[model samples]
Target: MVVVIPKKRRDGKSSFLKLVFYLSFREDNPGDIPVTADAFFDRPSTSKIAVFDRLIDYIDRHASPESQHLITHLPDGSHRILCEGVLCQTNTLSIETASSEMNAVALKNTRCKDPVYHFFLSWPETDSPTVEQIFESARHSLKALGMSDHQYVTAIHRDTDHLHCHVAANRIHPVTYKVADDAYDISKLHKASREMELKYGWTRTNGCHVINENNRIVRSCSKEKSMPDDAKKLEYYSDQESLYGYAVRECRPEISEILKADSIYWERIHAVLIRAGLELKKKDRGLAIYDRVHPEQTPFKASSLHPQLTLSKLVPRIGEFENAPRVMEFKNEQGEVTLTNYMVSSHYDDRLHLRDHQARMTRRLERAEAREELKLRYQTDKKEAKCPSFDAKNRFRTLSMTFRFRRAHVCVAVRDPLMRKLAWHVLAFEREKAMAELRLKLKEERAHWYRAPENRRLSYRVWVEQQALKGDKAAISQLRGWAYQAKRDERTAYLSDTVIECAVSDDIAPVELKGYTHHIHRDGVILYKKEGVTQMIDRGETIEMARPFENEGDNMVAGLHLAEQKSGEKRVFSGPREYVEKACSLVRDLNEMGETSLTLTDSLQQKRVCEIRPQDKPAPISFDSPNLTP
Candidate 1:
């Protein structure tokens, strides 16, 4: 959450001296500061004073003891020589190397040689180091910035702490200084900062968002609804645009404001001051490359706040004063004692998960890629198997031709099952229409004088009368029977009482019905003439058949055919039991071939199904005089 405020963010509202005022006062009084600072001392840092004072006020009101401490930078002008304080400034540098060359690009893209840029360096008390360590670390950090194709240069000033450093690097390549190609160029720097922080555990004190996939939609739903429980994960989804008073440009949201007709992305980020609340500042055109969202969230700036609250006094107030203030001490009675400087053991460790997760991800990616390569090599001419020239292996090949399709279903669980159950109601309606046509055609085949359905003027009553006059007994009976069945079918099919008399029914012509049912459909799930039984399976419903036969013919030839829903346009498996069993098995195999199975995805299929084969079949006996069943 480290954010930088550009010079143009405000009209010199927060300066270096004022920043100092805030910090100095924060040490004295918690948040008790006048809105206006009429009483003032002519200190060198006015903005820094204001910033420090605000920070103290913020900490006193909001920060916990564990959270409130200030990181300081020892500016270049305070060095001394031979016990004599010098007016001249001396600067040093330090750099760190990254493990992976790919990750080292950030350090390679910056170029800086100036001293004032030291304004950004963190100045912890012990950061100062010997001149040798300073130059060596500087070279490492510079190498991190990179050079060449996409390279940068960095200069560090480590003279302050034992090994403290400042990196003045450009966001773009040093030789090219390439302008960013996004909504803004500064975002590049923000991303670079984030990469550095994540890869290296650098702490940023600005507001941070919790990284999650569903953050935005979940936030919107919770905000719009009365969801107290949903609010827990909402914290990390917000953006941090302010630090003390600096503006950070990140997380612009797409919104359609009241006055605006079209939608535009609005800058939505918060500023962090110990106790400051959320701020929803809007940017009309969106953030520019160098633009800061809202720079002066607080009333002060940094340069003015540093001096009076030196590491010496402010440390005790925040209660983080680490080193003893005692320069030298002695005691003499019967014995004498003297003091010398000694370093405390360090208590810090690097983030281990960062490296570990990266390694796992890389390995999995390599495995996936290897699988892809194997498939590619086998697809040389998929036109023919084994080039016919190598007919020896035509039945089988040593190399696997397996591939993972991009859209292959790996695994699925239905989120809503009821919707699926409702959809099957339509299928029942279609079957009913087909059944009615089949009955009508049977009457026509008996020479019943029924007008063609194509004739709009022919009424159902008139058609029945004409058929009855022809003296076709079978035709009359079937006509009557079909009418009753159609009504029954329509009533039994739907979830609601309403029946569908749609185009499929009305469009069935009298002539078309003559041979409309030349091929009978016997879906295994719902067949009216299946084994002297009529089945009506609901959507998501499945049927299992007991193995009826387990033997083949000795002197008799046996044929076992598997049928799935009579091979109709809509497969429902209302056919013979043997056919049904085979259909289900084949389908199960196809489903298992997929990484994610169809049955797993189907919300209606809530129960598990398994079918076991007998593995042995008795021989069937055949007799010409007397038919013997196996």
Candidate 2:
């Protein structure tokens, strides 16, 4: 048995006294009452009195029921009868002037800051004393708490399964004219209740024990009571359950569809709950749904009903719904960009996703432009070169070869030499620019490898590799642990790029000839083959050659190889056809004049080559050249 001091809740627009009186005595509005009633068993007495003796008699009559006799023990070892019988009367407390007098006392003690000492004395419904015993126990407990000199009333309510009493004691003592402080009253009541239980021979229940769901003490049987027959229970059933069972069941298909699609909002669940006579209300800790008819009952947690209704689950869905506006960027044929919708929703993630999508679209658009540029360059080069177009042999291929040969020959007389040279120069510049970008990207990739994550160790694997080289045992262990993550990390691996390298082949034409393959290797080397010699001409100054030679008639097969030092490495020079022809003519003149025995020094050859440098180089001398005989 526990004398529970429930927090007093004021009735709407009611004074303190009136609210307390209504809580202890009313029957019309259940919300006003402090305690629920199970059944009206008996009203032993009812009266309206202000006289001291009359108040005592009123209590005497109310405490003694017809079915139970009241016995009081005196200090002189004598016993007396305290009450008579039950009285059938109307609600006397509701019509009494006690409220007004209490109100007057309350007004007189305006300085008093205490609240009405209003509380309930509840017992377990299954095992409790009779009404007379409960009334006597409450009276004795209230007096022991220093409320004996105060005007108070006790209403025994049996409307609930438990037999309980509602006590509304005025805090301002009428005689002492002093305000009462009932701060320690709860501790006194607990002690008194324990003594009363032993004195009255009732079942002893523990106090300040069992905790309810709200972390408050379960002071009464009311906290443990099951739902009334008329009140609805929220239960998961295959057929029907809860007040809004039909609506809840109706949402199954929508839930399935939403889950399958993984989209939309939680509006379907909200609508379902609303249709089922339930509403979602915010609590301090979470969200709960309650039945309209029985809101006083324990509410069903939204999460308890279903996994989908949890706060975490609903946040993203609700966020998506609340932020459902799409803003897209469209480009006109004139290349002007415009937003499809001028207004967008005020959600950060929505704007972020939109920005990401637009960026991807822009990248795709750039790639398309790059492809178009490549096609346009191909067409322009073909138009610039005056090469013969053949349907079987590609016109683009013929144009490309002629343009490359004219550019590579450096001094050759070919149709539209300047335009072909410009075309070749632009292609080389573009390739070099592309290679520079790739190199920069590769450098960034190497930096990214150092920042790659380790295996669940919150460190970088690059540091571990450094430690492993120093033979640190811990670093070795860390390295082993980090290896798995390193393998998993795509960034840690070497990212490859298209690098520029010179390619050598025998099928290509020589620098002097114009036919077949005509692509310059990325290293700026032009490879060409003519007669029995294959030539590799490097841009700027140097050239190299590989050949087989034979003596024809009086012409000597003297293979004079000259090497020039570039960056401390010797590079061979392959002569232009005109220069070679001039050199051969000079040599033939020397031999005819019988000057074969003359010493040929580097200075003499350099002077002669400088003299012929002003003339534009001609194509390679074929076997049919007028100056050559086979």
Candidate 3:
């Protein structure tokens, strides 16, 4: 099933560039495998802006050896750059340039509180699509949401079992500078997901919007039978079966059977509900079912469960709306007061146990850390008390004396009219300095207290993340489930690992090439990166290149020289016509100058090398490009 999730930042501090970086890089350990695919759509005239430069530098910095830590699984010197492309950009701007333009356009519109619209399109573990398919899906989905003209950055990640795509789009138009309409966005997304599932032959999942009998998209529930917004949220976040859902799934059929009696009454309905550990109660002029154990929770509306269970329908059939008897007369076959006990869900017990265990561990660790911190604080206080310069009592006495002297001076000056003004000004200046010092000291102390390790308690979410990093499969599953839940919340983007494995050769020793930062994977796959250039040398069998710009042939040639030097063999050169011609020219010049023995073959002479192509052109631009005059 395909899930479309729109993410929003409740704090109103979202940034386009920040979202781009997050989607394109790993958060747990920044130096590991980065983006699997990165692309841009609907950008401005040029990409040679300052923002693009900064982005390139940022990527290069992270890929450097200095960023690697022990936790990084890659070899000590290697870094990986998977793939990057550009689509529907004016002037055919690069992804970096397009992202920079997106941020600039967003900054121009101050009225729009959130200019960046972030969302995710995810598929289940059973379905896996190629990189091309992911890009195609993103384009189709964005067009469905009326965002074909918006500037956006998309990246595909493969860190988890399921493959997902992240699209960070600018809400403000480039030329019009108006915010895009987002009304009924969830409905639009549901319709889009349904379309994709049908087109791609994917498994279908339940949603609020569905295709109707007329073959047109429509909402599934009527206004009266629709679920409350709060109940929907509860179902999304908890993941466990909600009380309302439990009633409909387990009790609705039995209630229907009871209503088929020859002469129905309130007692029969009550007895059936009582056996199922549920009770029917009057709720705001309507009948609702509440779980016997969780009376405080939200109840399921009778009409929402089944039409026959509604108060209007039940009252007409059973004579009047009579309340269930309060006597202890109902009993199940087991002679127990209740049977078929209601549970949140089958997994509730496991979730509860995990939650309790985590809480206990957190509390124990916090207590131990707190005691150690207290001991250290007490020792520090003792040392400070011993030092006369750090004595609190002396400082208090000095402050008191200063205050008294200032007040006495002011009083004396007030008696002499000429000197009163001068004395008051001097006293005020001294008082301001003293207050400033006190405020600064207080700020420093507060900061130190908050920054202390012992003062920062671990939350359940953070604890789960820590465990997942430690390779706990259960923790990983829980974390992934949380991501699925957040699809309904739509408040944050979820990212997983993006590690890719490449073939490695054991015969060749590592070679350090000039002007390129070398990143070696744990399995001996070496990646070389420079400005506007990315080349991967997996042992000796294959040479891969990432060309995100129009003109970087010199850098590519330099990388190829290094690859040939390390491999000690002649490699075929195959790519687009332009790149092939350029490689031939450069290699010929080098061989003639006696600098190297290099050979080149064009696409016509040999089979073409796989090339990373831009996505199909997006729908026509919504706004005209701004005309520039010099």
Candidate 4:
């Protein structure tokens, strides 16, 4: 069992309505709320609660009638509602009324920042609990958290591999307007999960709290053993074992045995570690195991692998620290190490390319460092030069003006008009030249002082994305691995699949056509925008509107046409009957206008030619044709 409390939005704001809406629908299709009105109204009720009745009434009035059958079917042939409302308030209120009341109560609390608590409880795939069991578990978990009296909305979602229930509880009490105490919520949730697992005889899962031998819940003291954070993230994103993890898994037992021997020596440990492509070295105040192949990467802390490997412990056992030999021969042949930088094992060529790119980046970083040093040197020189202060410079300028005026007076005192004029001219030329030189010097100094450094470096993920955009298969694979690790929804997963083959063509490039602007993303995902609004997304193999709008039919037809133009092939539009009909109608219109020649084929491969004849109107397309597949 896993219980997760999602963090609040980055802005630290909570909206009950938005959370409810998200819980009520599938991530891909927001237009349809999968919960039926009947199922919602059939929920257990303590009284004819006005709030609950109001919410049901609202759903009945606005919810789609066809939503009653929106149950999702698995490939195994079992069907279940994608999302079902399991429980609400004891008074049985609708989602809208509950949100409204919760928002109203939240307004009374001026101190509380986050007014909503959104948490989810999930069971393993092996267990398939009924709706009543799920509801009871949610009620039990909430009651254990001291949120029994608070307004909350709970729904069961079966869209994923595991069965899970989402609970959105208002932190502020509806009547008292006091925020619920959420201290130790994680421990409380874990305790609740343990209880539910026991009560239902479900599969047991580890948590922070566990039942002791005395049959009482106690805080678990067992240390959680796992890969290092960086190593774990690398494994997750690259689908390869990290160097630290590899050392721990493959080399730890032998190293531990060596440490356990009667005469523990540093040579024996170093030999074993080296055989595994690892080296033990002193780092900081402790020892660390560094990857032999990629020394630039982070190393594993010695104590993290085994307590006895610590510098203090090992020093006491072996007398003192001893460095490994520069070269050593092993009786057994050394096997090749699978781990590399970022734990990338597959796609060796791509790995080499990435390494080369990183090398270039390292050179860039070196240049940036050199520039920084130069900048600092320039700053130091400027400081040591002791340039004139602002006040001193102003005073000097005044003195110079006074000297010039005195010089002019001296020229006038000569009592020769021609000599005085010539002296003034010479002084003006000298002053102009001096001012120009000063201006040029100040401009150069300003340029040097404000020159920005080229220290920008792209992160690994961003670099991979850039490579993927350039149609690198390995980069695309790495991105897909990341998406898989993220557990993105089905639509996003499909979009992240193998990159579609896109033939280079100037016609398909980003440009405005018939008021719609086309934009292509990585892996040939095309987006059609109009007036700065995204209208549709064409993922080469599939096309979907961004949202349902009045002109969705037009957008759909336009997307199909654009996709065809880009692919240089005839495209078949497959979707709801209405959308297909609209596309066929548009195609017929285009054919009748003598602008494009096209033919519509039925399911039986019978093609109907659309011929432009100004003398007679064309026959209307038959939707009820027996041969048509719509």
lDDT (Cα atoms) of all candidates against the true structure: 0.27, 0.43, 0.54, 0.58
lDDT of 1: 0.27
**Please, what are the lDDT tens digits per residue for candidate 4 over residues 1-630?**
788887678776777766765566443321111112121112233233633463475566555544433244334232333223323322224445557777888899999888889899998978888877886787788888888777777778765657788888888877888888999999999999888877787877778888776666678875325567787676655555566666675577887788778898888887777766677899888898887666786777887777678877777778789886665333334665444332222111112111112223343343335434534644564455433333545744865696598676867686788887777777777777776676677667656644422222334544444544444434433433343333223323232121222222112333345978654333334456789876765543345654332564566456545554543333455555544544555566665667555444343211322332333443555879887767
lDDT per residue (tens digit) for residues 1-630 in model 2: 767785554642224445433443422312111111121123223323323333344446553355334344434232222222221111113213455666667667767655467777888756667655876776777777887657665666655546676767777877666887777777678767777766765666665333345534345442222333322322311111343332234344554456456565655555545444455666665666665445764565555444465566667656632321233558899887655443222111111111112233343343334434534644564465442222423633554566466556644544586876776677677656655665566567655653444211212333333333343333333322222222122111111111111111111112223421222321222333334333323222233333312223111112221111112122121245433444444443554457542223344443554443334434555889788998
- How much does candidate 3 score in TM-score? 0.47
How many residue pairs clash (N, CA or C atoms closer than 3 angstroms) in each of the candidate models, in the order given?
88, 11, 7, 1
Q: Model 1 over residues 1-630: C-alpha lDDT tens digits?
A: 233333322332322223222212222211111111122112333354455554455435453434333222234322211101101112211111111121233334344221111113232343334443443343343333342123222223222222233333323442454422223323433444444434444443222222234322111122221212222122112111123212111111111121132321111111221112223322332211111223333322221222222334333444332222222335478565554332111111111111112223343243334434433533542323221222323312311111112112111232345643444454446545645665566556433322333322323333333433343322222232233222222222322111111111111111111111111111111111224332221111222222223222100001111122111112233345444344344345444556223232222221222442334222335564366543
- Order of all candidates by TM-score, from best down to worst? 3, 4, 2, 1
Error of 1 at 574 (Å): 77
Best by TM-score: 3
Task: List where candidate 3 sits over 4 angstroms from the true fold.
Answer: 7-22, 25-100, 103-118, 159-161, 171-188, 208-228, 235-242, 245-250, 256-265, 291-300, 315-319, 329-394, 402-630
Clashes of 1: 88
Better of 1 and 3 by TM-score: 3
Error of 1 at 273 (Å): 28
What's the residue-level lDDT of 183 in candidate 3? 80
Winner by TM-score between candidate 4 and candidate 3? 3
Off by over 4 Å in 1: 8-40, 45-185, 200-630
Distance from true position, residue 447, model 1, in Å? 99
Instruction: Return the candidate ranking by lDDT, descending.
Output: 4, 3, 2, 1
